[model samples]
Target: MNLSRPLDSAGGTDDSLGGSLAFGVVKSERQRVGVLAVLIVLLIAALLWSVFGPVVMQPELREKVRASLPFGIGMLTVMFLYECTSFGWLTQLIRKGYEPVYWVRVVNAVIEPLFFTAVLAFLIVFVGPLNGMAGPAPYIYFPYLALSALSLSLRLSLVSGITAAIGFNVAAFFAVHGLEATPSTAVLVSFPHYGMKGILIVLTGLAAGYVGHRLRKQLGESLKVARERDRAVSIFGQHVSPSVADRLLHQSVELTGEERQVCVMFVDIRDFSNLAAAKLPGEIVEYLNQLFGPMIQVVNDHGGIVNKFLGDGFMAVFGAPSEDLKLARNAVACAREILSSTDRLVAAGEIPPTRLGIGLHVGVAITGNVGSEQRKEYTVIGDTVNVAARIEQATKQFRAQLLVSDAVAEQCGPDVAGAVDLGLVELKGQPKPVHLYQLV
Candidate 1:
């Protein structure tokens, strides 16, 4: 799920979390561009208010504020245009799945605060140095500094904050130097006041950066968890009941090897080789598909899963994982349903006339993921599994469509107790004969 893009060298992407943070960066830049436009509109509105509305001030002070307006507006206009173009470029890169570069963000962060400094410079040129050193011009830096947090990047936030502090202090210091000859200017040019203000701006930048970084980190982790959950469901859900699949994935059921009592069912198509021998491969495949499709649904409906296909037949297990105590009864019900379903298929002429052999057994078996790391399988492997297969084979000798070991019959009691006893049958490779019962 790590979606890495090759835009890092171009400085157009964030590859730190495998390009996960790139989209957020681009989205933040687009928002910053909109902020610039709003700031310009507000500046123009202030200019209009100053020009047309009744504003009381000394003629020199009024001219000073008016003089700073054009300079401030022009600088903002240039910055806005630059930001709009940069946002467009980042948008283009993102559409192509490239990582957006950081240089544009880096440049914008450092340069944007200096626009207010330019307004301060114009104030020094047109008015007494007091307005430049201790006035409203430095306040403009705070808005953009606050916006740096929207980038979800601590570095960019800090850069914007630091630039604002440096630019404001430099402009204020120059204004103080201009008042050197004035004896009254001594009280007005306070270094500690300006220095304390600069420190607070830098601290604000640091705090904003920390918040942005934390937000970005949380987003990355949440995306990872969701993707991993989807992957598990996609890969493992096919072979199990949906309920079982959910429990296994959510850690309620373990996939690792463990001993659990289960009811195992093995189903085999009778004389399938002879039936397939005369037909074309495709024809035979279609025939098998028709028979098996509904049979699989029957298994799933009975709290079971067709764990794996064994060529002409498949092995299904009831209880799905190991949580159901009713596995024996469910497996018995599923076998009878499969038999009824096949009858309906043949009756409707949906498939060729077919016969089935089903065997059910109940016992402790080792169930878990088996095979190599690259090619693993979830399965049951033990005497219980072997006995189930053997019982399916004996169905031919007994002339029965369904058979169950005494263990399964006993477990299910009344529902399965009526099964006709087939006597102690000596199954192949068994040390002793197993009590078998016929259901068909």
Candidate 2:
């Protein structure tokens, strides 16, 4: 019922479905209003013609004019009706990601017009003869029949002017020859001639529809591709860190928190300051994205929540109000995963090979909204977070790629075997010197 990004694991929900439907309804109504406006214009022209034209005119000319008006109006009406059908079907097809311009639509267009034209032809032929036989010799029943056929065909074709002219003349010729039953001085009408003309028009429509359908199909494919490309570029530009923009994009997830023990990881790229100082702002952002993409992927795969993204790094918190208790293990796994994935990225010439330092700590922390009421962030704040950052910083002194505090090492348990003593180190903002270990 819902629509979502193809990359997202969770399929869309009812809300997305509702949103799509609302947009579709609005668009359909707008089109309908436009069609109504056009019909109104036709009405105004019809009214003006009725008022200006004389009631009594030349017999031949009067017949021609009367026939012509209905022919044009009937065709226009049929065209409007079919357009509504085609437009509605096409909208649904495009929205659902299907190519609607297939052989089927062509077939429908042909069949629809033919069916409508045949109905008009039958009414004209059957009705015209009865009216003519009972009426005066100057009765314009034949012209009326010709006009009805012309209008039905012309409207169906959507090219009324020249086509209607040719058709009217042709129908008049056939009527004169086929209805020889009446005296030379009397007017006559032939149902058989109208029937034959209907068959011809239907056949012509089939051919035209087939060709038009193919052209529409090709044009639709190119148009779809171009629009998709534009959409992709727009999505990419709109992409933001899930931590910041997830609330806006996904309305389903409740953006709230409860106090709980959580594993926190603070990671920073080595020599990040020097790199930023050398590169331009745009280059720096691009470079950071290249380095951060894989690292972020590792965290997300391990079921960790990215809390905040720093300029040259990101802060990840595992096991919070919305996380599993085994968040410490997940964090350690993520760090190892990031280290492994970076090797491939370096070889691809995307990002330079650089060492990443991560500090992991697990303990009771006031993990919730922090900062002033005007602007707040969901983060972990306590000795546990501070200790994690200190241990990671210890990596520089020990000449190690990864470093863990005594608390994190304890949580890691017997699974973590290789460890080197970094001795006691004065942690900033803390009174006591904390013991650190290097993962050898």
Candidate 3:
């Protein structure tokens, strides 16, 4: 049996993590929309104030303000429609399990500046000539360009900047050459100044694009590291406690093989062969899942790492990959919890009456990743693991539910003070007799 395969394979750690990341993306998008809505409201209020204040204070300015009102309304309407469409498109892309296109970003980057340029043109051509109040449109390019750099990619920001510059130059040309009724010597004199502003616009775009490029690169690297950490946690977290997994991720503990004192535990389902013979294959698998689920949880909760699963049992270790001073006690506590949980399951009629043989031994073992380059398993090996298995088998002869070597009993302190000693047991394949203890 492949112990690496989780009991609930369909809803493993990877699926849970992926679901969480997707939810985070959705939440972030919703927040962006909310912010955009607030900004739109503020813009509308400002426009209303500007248009109404002039009309009440000076009656002569009413016609000028009214003429600009239609342009303002048109620009705002376009902006609102664009925002709605962009938000809808982004939502649809996420639902379909795809990232939104770069063009969407380009549109968002360019639209605001484009609208601003249109408003400037409206003022110069319609409002300015009527009221004789326009000189040069306020430099909307710099502020909008800065916003684009922060929120967009290098290419998108640069393209938006260039587009704004071109639009401004076109409107300025039409204002000076096409709209003026009397050709003035002053227009030619200011031509060089306007040309310098155009050059500055292009330079600003390049600088902002470079900053955007660097920011995007940094953000990508940060996200990559976060994803790697998440993947490591999801994979390692299955076999070990979360704290152990975290330590492994942060390199706080060495993963390479090392000799350490470990408490190895072996748990076997007694008479499992008979149970399998009496039921269908699917039923046997379901029963095993029901049996192992809580058992694994108990081991994890007690700070024991489940190393591997045998055909009808599993091996767990306390103090591998990371060290614990009370490994023997934790192993014993985990075994007791498993037994208690099994009794409850039987009483609830979730499974037939069942018995488990649990064994524990504390000794020096080599712990590390073991297996081929293509596949590896983190586990423990040495005489300690072998002794633990032998102790588990001796439970059948002694008619006991739990057995542990003298070393484990001694290390467990007062927790096993009431344990009964089964002395001088001759274990198979061992020349020396080993002292054993049984939990009543």
Q: Which ranges in model 3 have alpha carbons more than 4 Å from their true place?
A: 1-144, 153-189, 206-256
Please report the candidate that would top TM-score against the real structure: 3
What would you estimate as the lDDT of candidate 2? 0.55
Give the per-residue lDDT digits (tens) of candidate 2, residues 1-440.
Answer: 23212211222432233333333333433353345435534543653364356555456544544564555456546655665665565466446533222244334424433433332343244335333233232122222222222112233233322233234334444445554465643434554454454455444543443443454455446545655655554463234334434432332234444567778888888888887888899998898888887787788788786776777777777875355766777778788788777777888878876778877777777765545545545566777777777767767776677776677678877646877767777777678887777664
What are the Cα lDDT values of the candidates? Answer: 0.77, 0.55, 0.73
After TM-score superposition, the amount by which residue 34's alpha carbon in candidate 2 deviates from its true location, in angstroms, is 36
Question: Which residue pairs does candidate 1 place in steric collision?
Answer: 11-101, 12-99, 12-100, 12-101, 13-99, 13-100
What order do candidates take by lDDT, descending? 1, 3, 2
Best by lDDT: 1
- Tens digits of lDDT, candidate 1, 227-255: 57766776667655465556555553334
Q: Return the clash pairs for model 3, or none.
A: none
Selected candidate, larger TM-score, 1 vs 3: 3
Query: Can you give the TM-score per candidate against the true fold?
Result: 0.55, 0.45, 0.61
Candidate 1 lDDT for residue 84? 73
